[model samples]
Target: MKNWAVISTWSMSYDGLLKASSMLQNGESAGDAVENLIKKVESYPLYKSVGYGGLPNEDGVVQMDAAFMNGDTLAQGSVAAIENVKHAVSVARKLSLNKTNSFLVGEGATKFAMQNGFEMTNMLTERAKTIWQNKVKEQFKTGLHPYDGHDTVGAVTLDQAESMSAATSTSGLFMKKDGRIGDSPLSGSGFYADSHIGAATATGLGEDIMKGCLSYEIVRRMAKGQSPQDACDTALYPFCEDLKQRYGQVGEISLIALNRKGEWGVATNVEFPFCVANEKQKAQILMANPGKNQKTQIEPISQSWLDDYQKQINAPVE
Candidate 1:
């Protein structure tokens, strides 16, 4: 019998993985398992970078993005900059299962969600609103808002039938420019799954991951016979290399992968906490290293940068 397993991008994803594990145990489809897992994360209020309590845009509107891919068919769907919907991953799954539409954005996405019977509720919570208000008052001067540390959430599943699926969801950056769609809803950048090869998903700075098509690169490497761990390491090397060349340090960049044989791995430029679970293993948080002897070059937001921004935020109103 093929082993069943699930892995996700962050520690918070442990909850989702637990849900996925239950579904897998009950014989759910791999696609369904992953979609349900991401949907759970989207509804979590504490993880402000995802669905319900996600950070707001420059206009204080919460816009979320999500994508889902089925490895067996190489089919996928995505929604971007969607507003008021609580489970963007479900909408993305609907699109992926749709024969005609592979992607929808902005008003179109919201309209589709409404048409599909998804309740249109204000996704921004009181806590998120208060934070947004403070951010606007400070003109985002600190660049150190409460939501800055939360990254996109993602999941990859390998089921007993050997099918694979990957899903990703996020609210994008905190106080981002209006209409800014990140890598989460974009194919290859946020998530990729291929039954013939494996599956891969990414989390961290969306712009850099999108430019590199990081998740796709990882799966492609696996297709070339690289192990799950090697594929993750190989895909992350250039991202770290580019950052080192430009800023002499890397920022956060993380990936999780599952090979065709059900072996899984994770790699990150910085210390990224993630989780893994399976039929035989319980979900547990683990730190993903860049690779063996791979020197970490991740530079934290500098104290000077934070200090300057703090001063600007504290400046007396004229």
Candidate 2:
């Protein structure tokens, strides 16, 4: 079995996964490795769904949600509807060390980050503002439901010491209501970890993701002797089907898991791209989609896909 592993939702996390892999290979703590990995994504301006350039709310404000979990202790820290913080994941990581009031929101969360010396910046960029403005105009003119495909960067890491950590960060859905928050900052919904068992995280419609507490379910199954892959497929596929039956519809849902042995698994109801690395493998991007019989089809991401994505994210907003 591999000695360490790191897996994260979305192809956008490829670079971060590489860095985190290097940290894990060098014997760094899983918590530090995962946090720094997310920090890389949070600082990238081209990723419109995460920290620096994340899309804004309906009122033109960039509100972010983030969470961090220490598998060794089950300690979790979270922030929601926070604004202006350069790395919302960092704020959440700091809160993980607290015993009370670890979950903070709105102005209170922002204040805690400020008081704790976190970097402060205008999280909304000109490009993001332009896109949000155009989206608003389009929705107003078209009178259609707002296009809502937001991707969160959720990661699970296992270190050489067998310690595990999970974290999630996102600016939330574009044109979201003011003070609105999603599953990213909510433990069990967005992320969960346990050193003795495994770690898992989810990305997609947080509202639906929370309805089933998908992440926690995956880890719970792993603790009961399920492989990471089995846990992810069994936990996610059944929930997706049940949600569709009960709720009449389901949103895009994707999940990633890594067990203490450095094995990994993924399941998704959409064409999801993710990044992963382990002691026996270099960091690489892969694609996952729901397949026949409720299994997930996994394959290497194509260069053509990467090229197109790069162009799309970097394209100028009209």
Candidate 3:
């Protein structure tokens, strides 16, 4: 009667190491696999928004970061402000598994990428550059830029019975320094998962991500008998309250969770908000994105659904 599922911080990644692993309900052979898939996806260029998609800068060049973790081992791999190199997560994974240190940043991570044979490139887009140029001309003191919700991606998964892993990748805030880094690649802060309390992941608004350790907080809440919606809602409630007190700026958080007994739930700050692909259910799997306006309808998983999911958790995907 155990449960397992994957929750990505953002929905845009198609080649996330953990995303690929979750789709197959496959347990990785080693910790390195988490980054391997992330790197492999970087070659396509289109997925750049997730793994290689440079975060749009005020001036419109790409800056990126990534991180990977194995819940079973609590081992961490991280890289910040790395440029051009795809599969940033893989580079970090190698560092964590092969080195004494748990993190690598900026030029250091890029060097590790080269040492490991990861090729570098100029990860810029014509459209994004044009937008930045336009912002510069608007005569505004603060140039405008777009949020690459598409560029940022994170992954969390609890495979079969009890294996959990999380991976995250992103282009940093647009118009940032040539070497700016965001929370996406920060362990525990951006995206984190632990096998002990099911799994959790987050996306959107990184600087404030540290405010409450959002994803992990939801996991702990779910562990304490809160439904997925309850856990996610509770997490967001405080975030909203704190914003009023701190900077008067409201923020959003997204989450998906699976409990130990084969039930699942999702919460977000928008509508038509998220998607899910399960071992048994793969077609048209989008779920509601939590919204600030309404109470998320909480439904109990029928015994049959729970039983079926339990089987899915333990059985290898076809």
Q: What is the lDDT of residue 143 in candidate 2?
A: 91
Alpha carbon lDDT of residue 236, candidate 3?
A: 70
- Leading candidate by TM-score: 2
True lDDT of residue 138, candidate 2:
86
Clash pairs for candidate 1: none
For candidate 1, give the lDDT: 0.82
Mark the regions of model 1 whose C-alpha exceeds 4 Å error after superposition: 140-150, 246-250, 295-318
Error of 1 at 211 (Å): 1.6
Best by lDDT: 2
Name the lDDT value of residue 34 in candidate 3.
Answer: 39
Off by more than 4 A, model 3? 1-4, 9-11, 14-48, 138-151, 259-262, 283-287, 291-294, 297-318
Per-residue alpha-carbon lDDT of model 3 for 1-318, expressed as tens digits? 233444443323334434554544554332333344455455444443554434355556666777777777777778887766756777766766855766777777777788879867677755445555665666376554445443356655556656666677777665666766767777666766666665556666677666768777877787788986777778776666777698877555555665543345666564423434445544123445444454454332345654654464244312
Question: Per-model C-alpha lDDT, please?
Answer: 0.82, 0.93, 0.59
- lDDT score, candidate 2, position 211: 98
lDDT per residue (tens digit) for residues 75-191 in model 1: 899999999997999989989987887799999999999999987889998878887888887765865544353389999998888899999999988978788987888889889
On TM-score, the stronger of 1 and 3 is: 1
